[model samples]
Target: MVRTADEASVFPDVVVASIQMAPKVGSKAANLKRSIELIEEAAGHGAVIAVLPELANTGYVFSSRREAFELAEAVPDGESASAWIDVARRCKIHVVAGIAERVEDRLYNAAIVAGPKGYIGTYRKLHLWGDEHLFFESGDLGLPVFHTEIGRLGAVICYDGWFPEVYRLLAMRGADIVCMPTNWVPMPGQAGEHMAMANTLAMANAHSNGLNIICADRIGTERGQPFIGQSLIVGAQGWPIAGPASKDREEILYASINLKETRRARHLNAFNDVLRDRRDDIYDPMLGTGWPLPRH
Candidate 1:
């Protein structure tokens, strides 16, 4: 974990708050109201950047595509996004939230970054989990980074964290910090083990890319699905700076990230200098092998 004194002395200070929001099952209006309350709370705590969990405006569990579609809304025009924008403008803070987006007839699990300046950008989930494939369409766009009052920020939805490539791509694209908003469910068997996965991903990605990684996960039960709220902030040195909270009531986690340390780490360690070490020419087989001898 990066110390506060070290962080204050090194880089421009930015306070990030991760909100563990509890969405009302299938109620967009109620969820939006609750999100606004959380945003105000974060702003009151002096947070420059605030992040909410994936599918925060509506519960993640759905019986069918119709349910997901019913909750989906347009980018800036959506009720959720508009409410978030209003809160951001009033609080003078930058906000990142995940929502079910409606593009024509198809639904996409999307994350939108809204601020006092209005909607900044949007990122749809690239990887869908299991039954999600049957409803939401996978995002095709690559990882993106945006310049804000707090500095360069990268946004990634839930399942996107499972892949290291997204982190590398964002880091290579000049993302100083990556913000992940997730609604991860704790299955029948795995209760507290999900934190390990989140920690490993945050540490490895931060260590390898020399960038800060902040995550916000949902809490409480929704439609019988229990979420493990392990919202946390990891430093550029691949260590937890703030949390690894367990599944419980809604909570807000705060941490300060040093941008200078990120640059220093990258300069000292050549992990981000992938061009000098990678051999792409010989790795074509990893994509697919043409080996075929027998046909049924």
Candidate 2:
């Protein structure tokens, strides 16, 4: 594991929190206020890092394009990002929350990372899901990892979780922790409150990539669409350290993570390295040129 002199000497137990709250449709003000409350609550509990659900400040289920358009704001200059930056600076914690991003004429499904120092970076969701395609422009920024005082932080939003490449890219970039801001709806044919596919995906992604993943999801139905509220803070071992929180209640989940151990855990054994053992040479021959047209 490659570590900077500063990072190597500063290993400490860090607490991560995931906030699961219900966001009202078209109520941007109420959603931002509620998000601030949850953030304050998490910070008070000694969480050094906190995650919030997708479109946390604007809410999901926009009645129309104009509704989404009206609610979207500019990136670090936006009110929502600026507010979160203020709270993060005041609480001395890192905040990762999803918001609607408006850049000139385009709107995007985006998440921003703010810390005690102020706004750090932004990640727009690379993959669009369902109605989101109608509202958001596909993310142009590739996977980026922000180096921080605590550890390296990487972020993903909602549908981006479905792509293994997202996690692999982040892990390869040496990210110690990944914060996911999601708005998961129930998948058809996947019934009951068993483990949600979102949780399963999070677990599998964490295990395969050998990085800790913290996920925050919303609860309650908006515009006849029900959200699967199972906020989680996964350890480096790919298991839940905190919660899959309740499916219907608004809650905050917290867990302590040791990032140094996570860096060591990526080595499966003396004989195998998860990233080093890839048969990419063979696979690349087929994939390097992009899909070679569908097999006849």
Candidate 3:
């Protein structure tokens, strides 16, 4: 039997926290203030890596293109992002939050990763969901893994989690953790009903790829659309370490990610390997091999 080792000695255990927020629409200043407060709270509790929800600076539902544009700001230098940077630097922790980014006249639904040093990197949402396409351009930056002093970190927005390839690609690139900033809404019948589908997706992806996933979701309803809040942090083994926080309350969820265990756990057994056993020679669209035939 393969046994687990001393977690602290291998690599410092990563204390991660998720902030499930409720941002008032068109309230940038108020939103920014609240986010900073929450980030500080997480940092105070020894969370080295903290994540916030989608469009955290601006409310999720937009009444007009002009509003989204008005709310959108330049990353790193943007009002919201800069404020977050200050908090991250002050608290000496890494912060990843979703924001609306504008370049020229085009706007992108994006997330920015900031740490104690300064801004690390950004990721625009690759898969735009529902009404998002009407307001923002699909992400062009692609999936980027930021190598930080803590570990290899990656960011993916709300809708991007639905695609398996997104998780797979991040894992293939040696990403140890993924920060998911989401504004999760209920599925067709999920409203105030069963467990949130978003949580299930995160867990499954983590287990399948041996990746730790931290999801921060927003609470409350906006412009008649209600967000299903159940922010959670899943370990590399696909177990919820912190929460599926209350569906209607603003809260924080915490978990510790062991990078060494992730690398070790991927071995599964002496026989099966999650990533190494892949038949990448077959299905990748870039290969120009077309659809593979039956294995007769």
Candidate 4:
């Protein structure tokens, strides 16, 4: 529930919103309705961009591939995508949200990027989590950054945050802000409601790449799997500016950010720039030698 600034007086570059909501399994109709309501609410608050949790339309933790396929739909043109696009257009805001994508017999854990003009692009989850391996294919669209009036935008979903290469690649492509649609679960053997490791990863990557990040996570248990809901927005300096919201609640977090600061923030002090200071010359050649350097 943190407000970055007095959104009323100071008009920052953009007011971004991260929507955290729990979607019921197999309840596409109800999910879509609820998502639309939340989106409208975000727009009402003057948010130029909004991010929603992963698998927002269909929910997570499907029992089987058949169940997943039944809930999945085509990207950009499907019922769920169209509804979100329509809402974004009506609200005059941009939206990044996850959806279960179906391409013929294959399925992808994907997120859709849409703007006031219309649909922008899609990002398939590069890394799949447990049980997801049986239902979804590895993302084929490497990492894509979309250019708009607001800034250069990129996206990743859920487990993709684990790989620093994902953020690096996007930053190398001139991404200013990265939208993450996640359904985070509690870490193995970790107890007491401390911050999820996922949030730390987001913060670290943001600082490393000098990029702003918006993370939206879901809450509640589906079937038997439980989702942790510590959604947050981190500035380029790698600090939470909005929230690590309630562990189990449906809410929206807003952050007023100037994406232009990403470039400035990279210049740490006077001499060190996060991206420029990278020892790429020493790292690139060794990358192919299986030396543990990030390839993508």
Q: Which candidate is the best by TM-score?
A: 3
Worst 10 residues of 2 by lDDT: 287-296
Instruction: Give lDDT tens digits, candidate 1, residues 1-296.
Output: 55677566646778888888788768888888888898899999999889999989988888889888888899889788888988888899999998899999988888898888888989889999877898799986667789876678998887788787787667666778888889876544554454556667788888777778888898888767777788888888788887876577788889887676665666544464432234545755432233231110
TM-score of each prediction: 0.86, 0.92, 0.93, 0.92
Which residue runs does candidate 4 get wrong by more than 4 Å? 1-12, 285-296
Report the Cα lDDT for residue 114, model 3.
96
> For residues 1-296, could you state the per-residue lDDT of candidate 4 as single tens digits?
23356742342468999999999999999999999999999999999889999999999989899999999999889999999999999999999999999999999999999999999999999999999999999999988889988888999998999998888777777788999999999897656866789999999999988889999999999888999899999999999989999998999999988854666778798999777677766876322223332212
- Candidate 3 on 153-178: residue-level lDDT in tens? 98999889999989888887788999
Model 3 CA deviation exceeding 4 Å by range: 1-10, 191-193, 285-296
- lDDT (0 to 1) per candidate: 0.79, 0.87, 0.89, 0.89
Separate clash counts for every candidate: 0, 0, 0, 0
